[model samples]
Target: MSDCYELFLTCPKSLEGLLVEEATQLGLQEVREQVAVVRGQGDLETAYRLCLWSRLANRVLLVLARFPVQNAEDLYQGVLAVDWHDHLMSSGSLAVEFSGHGSGIDNTHFGALKVKDAVVDKLRTADGVRPSIDKVNPDLRIHLRLEKGEAILSLDLAGHSLHQRGYRLQQGAAPLKENLAAAILIRAGWPRIAAEGGALADPMCGVGTFLVEAAMMAADMAPNLKRERWGFSNWLGHVPALWKKLHEEARARADAGLAKPPLWIRGYEGDPRLIQPGRNNIERAGLGDWVKIYQGELATFEPRPDQNQKGLVVSNPPYGERLGDEASLLYLYQNLGERLRQACLGWEAAVFTGAPELGKRMGIRSHKQYAFWNGALACKLLLLKVLPEQFVTGERRAAGDESRSAPQNEPARLSEGGQMFANRLQKNLKQLGKWARKEGIQCYRLYDADMPEYALAIDLYGDRVHVQEYAPPRSIDPEKAQARLLDALAAIPQALDVDPANVVVKRRERQSGTRQYERQGSEGRFLEVVEGGVKLLVNLTDYLDTGLFLDHRPMRMRIQREAAGKRFLNLFCYTATASVHAAKGGARSTTSVDLSKTYLDWARRNLSLNGFSDKHKLQQGDVMAWLAEDRGEYDMIFIDPPTFSNSKRMEGVFDVQRDQVQLLDLAMARLAPGGVLYFSNNFRKFELDEGLAARYAVTEISAETIDPDFARNTKIHRAWRLATR
Candidate 1:
């Protein structure tokens, strides 16, 4: 045994650099960083200090030996060569943790077993006394790594992982590890902020991990001071006197730090269930006076510290793992951004998230980004300075002019072609505004590619405008198309007398498979618009199409008109706008079917918004499969499926042209006697199978379904009414 020991400090991936820096600061010499592991040289006291204070390390390993091994026997011999009496008592319990593979030991469990056998065999006495295996509460924890035919054996100086600071016994569904949370706080410059008497807040503080970690850091508390056990506790080389001195020093530093004025640290969670738990965690960290937890929603999360004090707004908002989780989370992130802008101006923000794309929807720019890992999921810590300049107004300036910000009171001037586009928009609005007000319609198409050069479909949803730019053909120069788009966007706000921030833009191209249904953005901004005396929810920014299909206005009205006292069915429901109409029109019952859980969830919200949840049922599955299994009959059925769909949830690709006959037959089977089946699709080349007309009385209602708004595009979609002969 020597006074100096070669040590390996292990941390979560992406924190090796930070660990190296911290270890070096803690007097570790010659520190070298590898992937997830930092190698350095330190004395026994330095190792102990790191176990107590190092915020980023998972384990501190004191290297005992390094030897080459070609097979399992070689590994056994190598372990046996170590003098067991120097480290562990013969009767003491131990645990063996082995990592890596090769040298004929491919399985980690087998490798660990072999190491344990060698250690126990070497320690056995003449009377057969030997160490027993204790996985938990082990007196000695040995770690072995087989790398490139060499075994590196070390003693785990930290008993359990250093991340278990002993405060967070209870956590949320996706609680960040203590060490990782500390790392995030450090990266967010909490130390600097705290030293300046600044405050800290987390709007979505589940279990108060960030709040506790920040308080501990600010109070200069040793992270593992309260940990009851350590791997070196029972080791023969343990130096009690030196350890006692270091522990007392840490305690004194914590006491002195606590004597200073406490920083304003608070956390707010939307879930009331987590509020008490978060307070418990804060109390466990001995920070009850310095921190408080409250039950509050993200929409109303405003952190009020002492007067004139600004700090950091840190949070790990849920980045959903499920398919449709992002859609709902978008608004959460957006709301978070909005709160920061409204309440925390001039303060700093650090949002740690697994979904960086969702972070972009926050409508703010992060000045810096740090990559980290939460277990296996790669994550990012976005650092933002919440200033007015960092706010995104949702308006994209033209290329080469992105740096210039438009004045708040003045609108951007339109180009010559933009003026023409603006005039056309004004003409259409004047013509349609009269009709819209006369009919009491709050949502309708104001412009639909009226000028081909500025190929756009602009719809007015209440006061906001939803603009969809038709992707230019290959023959047109992309730059020209982009210029035209900018022109149209600029003219829209002024031409329609709407705020620029109220416009949402998306590019519309020929979509294949389920691309059309996929989310184009995640702002999750939904607007309620009235049509036919019923309120419907429409998300202007999330999907390629708003939840409400404006072209289907007439058809939905028709459904509402004939729905009185009738059982109605909506196929490929798509947010169930028509079903809501049916429910409002006094339908006996309404069943809406769609394969997309996202849309079904939206449909549920739509139904709930209109107070029609009980009688209107929303089913999630392939429409065809659902129709086949359904045994109920309906007086009126509407089938408005996508032009083509290759959704993975379905058994096979659905070509509306190829599968119409089978689809109609399956749907018509559930249609009651004299029931009307209204079928529609947008495929321009689609031709109804002639055989269907012979079997049932079919009438083309395309003309009747086309409203004045979509009159210019009569072929936008074709509809037909089919009934039994």
Candidate 2:
């Protein structure tokens, strides 16, 4: 009976703004963007039009009910409150999709089961027959979201996601999602370019997602034309007459658009097998005449000799998702860049990649980078014009400068805030330089987020400087953070008298457990540096943390001083820097435990470099499990656990704040009488449990553990020496 209904259009993450624009363009009323979804008010025709025409939407859902729901009972009753007989028949099939978690329904499967039970109960009570559950092809699909104790139920107008346009019968390994491909095209201004009669090409098209989506946009083809199923198709409330009329109108529009001059859309693929599938998908989408997919290597990709056209070259290139994928793919990216530079001179390029670092290897400066989500992977769509002037010869410019007269090699002038940050870095260097020289220290932290505006840690590994910019809060403008990062990078080389090439930039985000230890890349270019009179290997580019922790310099030194003629144990030892120091200081034997084979290997190399043999052991296992089994007593022990880790290798999630008491108890049990256990963690808000402190002789030596190099920020790591009461 309602003329219009509240509707929600679900989209891939990071495309809310784009979807909002699309909804506005569709003339939907009260259009607003929410998290990963757009809300609007529209009649049945408006909903049908969006379901047909929207290229960026995943699903068009019609909101049916909303109410407070705390437990499974509340959810079931709330669902029952909606008259199921009005929307679905008792004999029909239905499916419920559950997302998010809350008070009673902690798991999606359980939540879905409860919703299903409620629907079945309501239907059976009314008509003596219950609807059957169909996961694959349901007559009716319901979407339930439990967010912040409120449940919003919606009927999925599009049975499956609109992205599954029914045209993609075949795909290659890691093919881009259709809606994601469309989002990338829109972000790259493909619609505008197509409007001006620009051609479209994909040199590395995987199953032709980009090309097909581009052709559909160019010809105004309804994306859902080939999709056979709709949620309302079997529903009792569906106005079949109205729906048929809308479908005929959409078909007419598609036919009229296709009659115009065909768009120049071509997809080139190196894989011979993928060509057929790509072509099949294009033809199925009814764009066979508008787009072409051909078997061709990236090296041979070029525009047709007769066409003489310039347009956009968009691609969703391989992002090296697996191990060993990067070793070969890095060169692929570089070669792709070369081929584009040689073949397409006037064309603009857009690359959608989950690995931005590999995109960086292309050696092309991206003019705009928009964040998008390819499924769960956070990816970026990089837009750049393929011009000779945009290419860099040596080191890339720290920042884009508009002045042509300025020397390309010269450092760009910093902003006012950047100037102040530079001055502070210089001052810190002056203050720390004397101490580092006097102590014969080759590596140390020069600045630690000294200026809040420039939240970066500048560490000196001999001549090379590692700069890690902390990811700013969501409240801060990303452009402002990028500008500040560039300012810091520009300032470091000039301030420290180091070459720009020696400077490595990395963005540091708050990480949990093993994620902090995961390798960003596998270059494994190790740099030998001296820390606390010990030689250590530190890699700046391959991982988030350099193999060595400069803040723990004092802790390692303390271990060395106390480890003479004593047994040393290092728990959660990454790279075993502490064990190396302990072995060098005359420990009877040293044991280092870590879960990662890569870091364990690095730790072995460190011990060998320090001339400590296998007598000093390195064990690979979960530290907690290892500790529970170990009966050996150690006079000196170091336990440094990650803040939180939900690694599959471990038994359960490890929370340093919650489990520290138990962890400390286990470590203390392994310590001999009067033996010292240096327990430390980098979790900023970590609080020592009162119960554990009361049980043991715990002394908070956090202040004393910070070295002079990290003097500016004493809370880099919290340390305490504990022993049995």
List model 1 lDDT by residue over 241-264, tens digit each.
Answer: 999999999999999988888899
In candidate 1, position 520 carries an lDDT of: 68
- Considering summed lDDT, which 10 consecutive residues are worst modelled in model 2? 401-410
lDDT of 1 at 621: 93
Task: Give the best candidate by TM-score.
Answer: 1
Report RMSD (Å) for each prediction in the order shown: 7.8, 10.7
What is the lDDT, from 0 to 100, of the residue 251 in candidate 2? 88
TM-score of 1: 0.71
Q: Which candidate leads in lDDT?
A: 1
